[model samples]
Target: MKMTDLILKYLSIKTEVKIPGFGIFQQKNVPAFYDERLAALLPPAKEFFFTEDFNLKDENFIQFVAKEKNIDINESYAEIAELVNYWKFTLQNKIVLEIPDLGTFYFNDEGNFIFKGKHFSTESPENFGLEELNLSELKNRKSALGKSLENEYKTSRNPFWWLLLIIPVTAIIYLGTQNPELIFGKKSFKNLKKTKTDSVVKSRNLLKDSTKIDSTKSKIPTPKLK
Candidate 1:
């Protein structure tokens, strides 16, 4: 079996697979994710993390490989050692090591191993047939709600025009209640009644004068016609 296949085999039944003088591979379960900018929901997934561990020893890995290849323990150990050394040497020389169907492994500036694997998928089998949702309409609704709230806030802060009208009227009511004579003088109703009566009499006199003028004009016969 290939070195990558052995690593996958170890990871299948065990939580962690460590290759002596190389790195450790482990499966980690990740929770569901929400991308606000994309307005998408991503399902839970399984991801692999690789950590360089040079001092790890796995007797079970050796036994499994020896049994699988039908080789003795010594021969299996030697073969495993050769492959691990090759990978380590290549990584030290700053060359990328790619495992087929697994991932590419490289060393960063911090000398830490970074793995980019093809086997890592965000789609979960448990979430089969599920697709990402587009929340564009919900975003529009939220924007409209924000604008409406802003308008309400502005309206609340601004003074009402009717409030200005109420001030003078309120003052009039208060003054009239305190001292009646201030707003309406003595005999206020009588004076108002007299004013209205005077206005009516004046209108009647004007009407009577217009009638007399018309009668006078009619009594004056037109100069005798030739």
Candidate 2:
């Protein structure tokens, strides 16, 4: 297409383009890095730079232009030389020179020839589009993890569990400190109450037989003389 467009394409392909009397255009490599805000990995990229030294055309670059323009190499070289002179004349007389989609060439306050690329986008074709991290989903996962931990703590504990073992132990200790016969002997408080009731019944029966004293005396069992 246009000569300026061809210059840009050459920069993309060869990574450098040197124009007589203007400056040399070059591309810089920006390596991939992690982007914290997006929480994603960014791809390697290309950036532009310019210098005033070695403003000479490359043989392969000239050949590329010749092939693209469907012209001979000598014709291509002459056209490129004329374009370079036009760029230099514009910058020297008009105080600025603009190359469409490439950059603007001008003298800075330091009287240095400088190039600033137009529409300087850092987007690289090597990138596979990645979505940004969702903060809401991250917070939800954190809350769920906290709830899981709480449930696990609750499941591992029984509030009244100590009572199950303590009650039996306390009862055993109290019984040990008291009379052994309460738990192991037949003549305990239950046996004493039964004995008292039996004695009272025997006395009542004796009173009922007071008029039959001789019958009662004969009924009593006695041991014979040894």
Which structure among the candidates has the greatest TM-score?
Answer: 1
TM-score per candidate, chains pooled? 0.49, 0.45
> Candidate 1, overall lDDT?
0.77
Query: How accurate locally, in lDDT, is each candidate?
Result: 0.77, 0.72
* Model 2, total clashes: 0
The weakest ten consecutive residues by lDDT in model 1 span 186-195
Q: Give the TM-score of candidate 2.
A: 0.45
Candidate 1 lDDT, 117-147, residue by residue in tens: 5434445577564555567867888999999
lDDT of 2 by residue, 68-88 (tens): 999999998888888877777
What's the lDDT for residue 39 in model 2?
Answer: 55
- Once superposed on the true structure, which residue ranges of model 1 sit more than 4 Å away at CA? 33-42, 109-112, 117-226
Score residue 143 of candidate 1 by CA lDDT: 97
